[model samples]
Target: MSGEMIYPRGSGAYFEQLRALLPRGAAWICEAGTTLGKLLSGLAVELARIDARGIDLIEEADPRTAYELLPDWERVAGLPDTCTGAPETARERQAALHQKLTSTGGQTIAYFIDLAAKAGFLIEIDEHRPAVVGMACDAELYGEAWAFAWTVRVLPFNGTQQGELPVAVAEAGDPVGIPLRGWGALDLECLIGRARPAHTTVLFAYEVEPEPALWFDFTR
Candidate 1:
C-alpha cells in the first residue's frame, strides 16, 4: 500500500471539498420547521465552523419566511444577507424566525440546508480534526425533533490500504459504497438533521466501493 495524499485536520477542509461537490446555484439545507429555535442554534454552529474554516459565505436574502408564508412558492425563507449575526443583538429576529418555523411542512429543512450548501456552508457534519467534532451534528436533534438527510464524511478509523478504502458518510439511506485512496475514518452522524419528517430529502455519503470509482484518491 502506498500513501501519497493529504487532508486538512478540520471540518472546514472537508466542508470545502463538499461545497465544491454540491450542485452549482444550490446550497445545503439546514432548516428545522416547527423548530426555528433549533434551526438558529444549528446555524450558529455552522457559522462557527464556517468561520473557523475561513470559508467565504455568499450572502443572499432569507427565503424561509417568504417560502413558508407565501403560496405556490417552493422558496426558502432565508435570513437577510445584511442581517446581523445571531450572537449579537439579534434575539428579536431570532424569536420571530422561531415562530415562523414552528409549522413548516416538508422540504422546509431541506431548503435551509440547500441554502447553506449553495452559500458554501455544509450539508452534512464533516470532521477531520477532533478539536471541533462536537460541532458536526446540530443540538436540536437531541430534543426528539425529526431531522432528515443526516450524514457526515470522516477519515476511516479502520480503513483498508489498497488502491481505495471505505469511509462512512452521513447519508440516510443504505450506506453508499465508494472508493478511497487510503485508510481513514468516516462518520455518518453529521447529516442527521437536514430533512423534515414525512419528507424525503436527498444528501450524499462518501464511502468505499470497488471498481472504476472516480472518487478514489483525494488530493487532500
Candidate 2:
C-alpha cells in the first residue's frame, strides 16, 4: 500500500479559515518587508488568488516610484478631497487625515512613517530586545470594510537557530497571551487573526511587493 502524502499540519485549516475570512470578490492589501520577509510571502500567494494582492514595503531609492508601487493608486488619487474639521474622536481625525494623504499621491517615506506612528501601526521590532511592531491592512481596498491593525512584540530569541520567532500580541499598550511562535503557514494565520481589521483605510508604515507570486504551485 502506498503511503498518503503528508503536508504540514494545520496548513489546510489555515487555508480554510483564510478562505472564509476573505471570500471571493473581496479585495485585500498585503505588505511585507522583503522577498525573505518570512510568513507574509506565503500568505500573500494564497491570498492574492482571491484578489488580495501584495505590495512591497521595502524602501526604494525614488519616492515617486514607491508611490507608484502602491496598489489601486489611480483610484486612491481619484477620491474626493477630505474635509478639514474636528472629528468626534481622535481615531476619526486620524482616519480623516489618512484618507487625505492616501487620496493624494507623491507621498514621502517620512510622511508614511509619521502617519503609521500616530495610528499606532509603526514601531521597531527586530532589535535584540522585545519590541513592538505595528502592522495594518487597508479597508479601502475592500471598499469601506473595517481595516485591520495590530501591535505585536517580537520576543528576544535566536529565530534563525530555532526556526521560529516568538511573538505576543499587545493589548492596552501591553503584551498579552502566551507568546506564539513560528513562521510557517499556520503561524501566518494566527498573526492575521490577531491583526483583524477595524478602521477605514488600512494604515501601514512599510512597503510590500506590488506583484503577485508567479511561481509557487500551492496545490499539489
Candidate 3:
C-alpha cells in the first residue's frame, strides 16, 4: 500500500470507498481517524445532538468520521479532574474503561464497531498478517436512526475467517444491559499464529465513515 493514499483508519476517502458496499439504513461506524480533505466531501456535517441531559454527537459515522467526532482524552467529559488522583488498581482501570466506553465521546466511536459483527467486521490487519473476522456479534443503530448509511471504512484484522481476534469480545459474564454483554458471552480465545513462533502480536480495533461522493485525495 502506498503512503500516497490514506490508510484505512486515517484516510477519509479510503473509508468512504469501503462503506459504499453496505445496504442503506444499516450503517458502519467506528473509532478511527479522518483527513482534513474529508470535510470537502458531503460528510462535512459533524453533527452534535444536544439535549437536556447533555450535548452529544450520537450520530452514525464510519471509521474515519467517528474518529473525527471522538473527544480528545484530554478533553473528555466526566473525566477525573487534574486535582483528582490517578487510579491505583486494575479494578479502577476496568471501572474507568467502562465509564469511558459508555460516555458520549467514547461511545461515539465504541457504538459503531458494535455493529461490525452483523455487518461483518475486520477486527485487525497490517502488512504481515492475514485478515481476522467474526470477533463481535452485531450492532443496531444506537443514535439517530437516520444517520449515514453503511458507506463506511473498516479495516479488517489479519485473518479472512471468523474468530481471529479472541480478545476483542464483549464478555458474556458482564451484567445485562452493559454495552458488550453479548448475552453474557465474550469471544472465545484461539491462537492465531502458534506456528509463527518468531512473531509477536497485539490487537486493536478501528472504525470507518462516509465522505462526499465526489471528494478524493492521495498524497501531500
Candidate 4:
C-alpha cells in the first residue's frame, strides 16, 4: 500500500478508527447504513472542522497570513494614534503594522533616511545653522531658532533608486519586481514627523524632476 493516504482525515478513516474501538460483537450495530454509523460520521465531520479551525488560527497569528485579523494586530501596535491616515489597502496596512512593530526608534539622520528608504523613498537631511560673523558670504542670516530646524529633501520618485523593498518589507506583502510609482509622500512625512526629536523642528523639501534637456537634430 502507498504510504500516503489521500483521505487521511476523511469521515471514512474516522469511522474505521471508531469502529475498531468498539466491542467485537458490535460490528452488526455499526454497519455502514446503521444509525450508529451515521452518528460516528457526523462526529468525524465536527472533528475535521475543529482541526481546520486550529490550522487557521495558526495562520492568522502571522502578519503575512492574517488577512481578517489585521485590525487586531493594528490595535495591539497602537496604530493610527500618531500615524494618521491609516493605510486603506491590505498590503499597505500590513507594511505599516510590520514597520511599527519592528522599529527600534532613533533620532539620528541616518536612522531617518533608512526609515524612508525602507518605505520606498529617497531623501537627504539638511541641518540648518544660524548665520555667524565667520560664515561664508553666500550664507543667509537667520535667527538662533534655525539651529534646531532641519529639512528633509525628498528626491523625485525614481523607481531605479528607491523601488527595491527590504526583505522584511517584501515578505510583508508588497509585490517585488514592481516599483512604487506614485506621489504618496504623506506617509514618509508623517513617519519623519513622528520620529523627530521633540525640541527640534523638521521641514520637508520635495524636488521636482527637472525637464529633460532637449537637443535639436538640425544636423540630420
TM per candidate comes to 0.18, 0.17, 0.16, 0.66
Model 3: runs farther than 4 Å from truth? 1-120, 127-199, 208-213, 216-220
Candidate 4 backbone collisions, by pair: none
- What lDDT is obtained when candidate 3 is compared to the true structure? 0.35
| Model 1 residue 28 distance off true place after TM-score fit, in angstroms | 73
Give model 1's TM-score versus the native structure.
Answer: 0.18
Specify the highest-lDDT model's number. Answer: 4
lDDT tens string, model 4, 105-127? 99898999998887678899999
| Better-scoring candidate (lDDT), 1 or 2 | 1
- Tens digit of per-residue lDDT, candidate 1, span 1-220: 2332222345334544444554554244423332532444444556557775443222212323332233222224343322222223344444435443563434444555554443233434422222233654643323222233333432222333334443334445544565333323222222233233445333445444433436566787
Question: Model 4 Cα RMSD, Å?
Answer: 10.5
Better of 2 and 3 by lDDT: 2
Please write out the lDDT profile of model 2 over residues 1-220, one tens digit for every residue: 2333222443444444554564354244222333322354466445554342233444222223444333343235432222133446534544444565554432334443343344333332211212234423421233212222332332222323333333334346445553343322233233223233334122222221223448788898
Each model's C-alpha lDDT? 0.38, 0.35, 0.35, 0.75
List the RMSD of every prediction in angstroms.
30.6, 31.1, 30.2, 10.5
The sequence of per-residue lDDT tens digits that candidate 3 reaches over residues 1-220 is: 4233333333355346545653555233322333433442223122211231132244213212232333343244333433223456545544543454554421222343443432345432332222235434453323332232122234533435553323234576866665551211122111122111233432333342323359666774
